[model samples]
Target: MKKTISFITENFNKSSPDLVGGFQGFQRAINMEKEDIIQEIVLSGLKGRGGAKYPTGKKLMQSAEHHDKEKYIICNADEGEPGTFKDRELLLHDPYGVFEGMLIAAFAINASHGILYLREEYKYMIDDLKNALNHMRSLNLLGDRILKTELSFDISIFLGAGAYICGEETSLIESMEGKPGRPRIKPPYTLEKGLFSKPTLVNNVATFSTISAIIRNGYEEFIKYGTVESPGTKLISLCGNVNKPGAYEVPFGMTIREIIYDIGEGIRNGNSFKFAQIGGVSGPLVLPKHIDTPFSYEDLNEIGVPMGSGAIIVVDSDNDILDYLDAVQAFFKHESCGKCTPCREGNRQLLNILSRLREGKYSQEDTINIEKIAKTMKYASFCGLGQSAPAALLSAIEHCPQEIFKRRD
Candidate 1:
């Protein structure tokens, strides 16, 4: 297969370098100056790959601007989303990339401590990260004065119990603080009150990992890959009935068709493509009509969908859209912490309506009620999971109403 994206292609030259493979002596601190590092990251136009699309440099600058006697950096590696494994691949293949990124972030923000919070299920990555940490320590990369510079930083690995809600930044902080993973109300955001109620910056593994390339090559070089609004490459985990089902790093503006047909080598076994979920559960269900849509935050949002955690799940003609909706609803229902009544009750009611639809008990009235409940969940819920719970169901119903509304007589 011909590789079209430069992000993966450029990195492929190293192709699992020995330094990334638990070997010591690779310089943890590169020769690049700190100002150059910030400029490079700013030019790269990188955004958080965790789906929010927040500008990476801006985040670092915000933290840097607020540097105080105590500040912390956090790498969110809890890959709990269904069908998303891009972070796992990055951690397994290029653990040092993440470490290097975190170090740069720590330096930029003058943070004294860093932590990589990973899911316990990713045992391999956890072990790999530990090995990488040890390797860095042996070279005097992690402890005390790093690379003989005045900057001192250390990273600790915290294993999460694998709750999906912990993927939320504040919730991850709450989890690391030895509490149940429930998202806190924002406005005194993580940059202000996070991790032990101190100033902190929490970013995804991929977002931090990209820092290596930015610092190494310069921001203009990084900016060469993506569009104006969303610069830099994004790693997408392509799964579900695609010829190529692994993770691949592609430029941000690439079309869905390019990813599906070219990169994925077209649907598996000649099955006709039905639809695809651009993001995870929080993302909207994209139909055939939206195939040409550019894979960027703005583009997806303008079209009523959000480019979430970059999990591209392709569904074929054989798959039932309603069943998929049911599964998604079940996930939200099960994961709801029940702190809020609308989410707790709204999710259960949505599940029941889906069950009624599946059993042919749904009338037009039931469908109307389902829509109403979904709207309520969207506006009334406290956190993101609850607010976005209706994304899949709403998209499925909007795009494939016939499939959902079909009578069983």
Candidate 2:
């Protein structure tokens, strides 16, 4: 049965058409009033695809309302989450969609400049991206007075220094300013003050691409797919112990079972399913029983999990929970920016506890201590890196307490 949908990947197998007659959506957007464009987006029910799930329309409206004339639009292409590579596919195949999305967002927000923060690991795609930008300029799809209109918006690519923390919007801005990529305190949020201390609008690659689609196809066409709460298709990165592991774009309402069995072709080598981690390493480990849960924000949030980065990693029965704990904890420990004491010391403490558990020396006090540190990091950390760092281990404890706290004999 054909289960995967093709919205973003529609042009994956073909070369992008020239923007001379294409980018009708971009043309449509510039012709419409900015407020109407934002209103249509709000009505479309499109939320941020970059894990935060914030309303895209609300974000645009906020930026548009700001009196700042030097607003900026940023496309966050730092695909840093473990096991998540959907953004790369978008930039690779649908580069035009990304560019058009940025242009639309720029026009709507009344911004003059834009930036695509490409990850350092994706240096290989730099030439192609530059070529695309140059091609757009030749067509007058970019640069001053695009399409002979009064709106003059331009986009440029900025390479990141290989910091996972830069995936966060403010931290990304800090890196663009030639500083260490650490998150800033909120209230003067990115929309109010961001890159170069100007009002900035930041969105992920999938998000910008979706914006172009929404405007091109019209919001009514977009609302036809997915659920009311999470209306629209999502590009999910499916990997780990699955038979057909790859990126699959599906609507928001599909159950995890359908994704793993029907879409992913079930567990590899006939092995029984153990659990699956929805989102990235920071997402929770969902047990086999909960596989029936729909892959939507409200559904997953009801179960205390997030649809982070849309990366689902399936696991087989052969793997032990402790192994995952050790691996994920190690990742957080290494990635911790040490900006906040709770995250820095908390990750180290969680790792220490995991080690003792592996050595069969864990006590009830160890479990209590792990919970203490995770809670602290979740609430007190300076940014999301620390807040979500304990998700995997905590979900492991929640779903398989026996395995996590069992004596390793």
Candidate 3:
């Protein structure tokens, strides 16, 4: 069967019939019953692709249910994960899809304002999004009286300084408000108190982009593509030693073997695959034994790893796993924001321990101490960054235990 969605397939490349018709379809769908749209989305089982994997329809429903006078829709385009760049690709080639998705979300939640919180490093995409916004405005798809309806919605592009933590919804809102990007405590979730302390629906760019297609095709149709739980498709950025390293939109339950071999064309230069990082830096490292493990949030979680940010970094036997762990430790240390002591000091200490180990100065006793510190940090850190920072290291220790052991005389 021919695939409907493929890796790197630019859905919004040219002014084709489908592209023009998609806007018209969205305009018509926006006028349809909001409850029906919600039902369709719920049936679709679309989850947030921005690492959290929260139900998109459920999030919109919460915002809709808690509709105060001022509700907002936020498109999280701050693709800050180190190895991930799929959102950047979507924004670059499919800006219209994202805009339509935002509009659909705004219509669902009765929101007036929409903000695309994009990263500053995505300069080309930012420019392209701005131009796309202008095009939508020219066609009267945005602004007051959208598509001749009473619904008045407008989208603004809010640029973010290159901060990884800001990719979190709360931090993104804070950054957009001209404050330092620090994650706020949950409980009073974004749907309750978000940007400007109003009810906001913040979703990733890819998650929102899928909304239009879901609304147009119905939820059941969308669900036909992937597993019952992880419905629809996922775009994963395959990098590091892959022959055809790029973005690939595959079904959710596809194995790592399928991704690396079928889609990625196997390892480069015939190098044997030793291990792989299923998610971004904050995700766990999977050894060759877990190659058959399906790529899904639940599957990864069951195995004590997370498919966070959908970035798979393959490592060969020749690569030093300890060095990779050290790099991960350093990344968390540098990006910790120093908001809380556990993360602030914990990451620093962890990096120091890893550095000492690298210099062949740490014994097994030091390794035990390092593990203890990581456990403390996991429980005490303020946000996901600090909490999951030790995952890479821990997974490395589990799979490559001998790598950390010193051969003494």
User: In order, how many clashes per candidate?
Assistant: 1, 0, 0
Of candidate 3, the 10-residue stretch with the lowest lDDT total is: 1-10
lDDT of 1 by residue, 1-409 (tens): 5365554324532433344432121233345565556666776777788878788878877777775777888898988888898888878777777777888877767889999888888875666678778877877668888878777888999988878899999888888888888989888999987878789999998887677766655566777877788777888999998988888888878888889999999998899889898777777788888899888777787788877889999999888887888998999999887889889999999999888888876777898999999989999999988999988888777777888887775
lDDT of candidate 3 over 1-409, digit per residue (tens): 2232642233657522235465644766766898877777787888888988888878877888985878888999888887898898777777787888888878777898999988889865666677778888887788888778767899998888888899989988888888899999897998999989999999998887788767756666667766766877888888987888887788788888888988888898899998888768887788888898887767777888877789998887778777888888888888888899888998888888887777777776788988888888889888999899888887777667788654433
Please tell me which predicted candidate would have the highest lDDT against the true structure: 2
Better of 2 and 3 by TM-score: 2
How high is the lDDT of residue 67 in model 1? 53
For candidate 1, give the lDDT.
0.80
Q: Which stretches of candidate 3 lie over 4 Å from their true place?
A: 1-4, 7-10, 15-19, 407-409
- So what's the TM-score on candidate 1? 0.93
| lDDT tens per residue, model 2, 1-409 | 5478877666664535473437878879988999999998899898898889889999999998776768889999998999999999999888988998898988888898989999999999999999989998988888889888877888899999888899999889988998888888897999989989999999999999888888988998887888988888889999999999999899889999999989999899999999888879987788877889998888999888888899999989999888888988888889888888999999999999999998888888998998888888889998889999998887777767889887766
What ranking of all candidate models by lDDT puts the best one first?
Answer: 2, 3, 1
TM-score for candidate 2, residues paired by index: 0.97
TM-score of each: 0.93, 0.97, 0.95
Tell me how candidate 3 scores on lDDT: 0.80
- How far out, in Å, is residue 35 in model 3? 1.0
Q: Each prediction's Cα lDDT score?
A: 0.80, 0.88, 0.80
Worst 10 residues of 2 by lDDT: 12-21
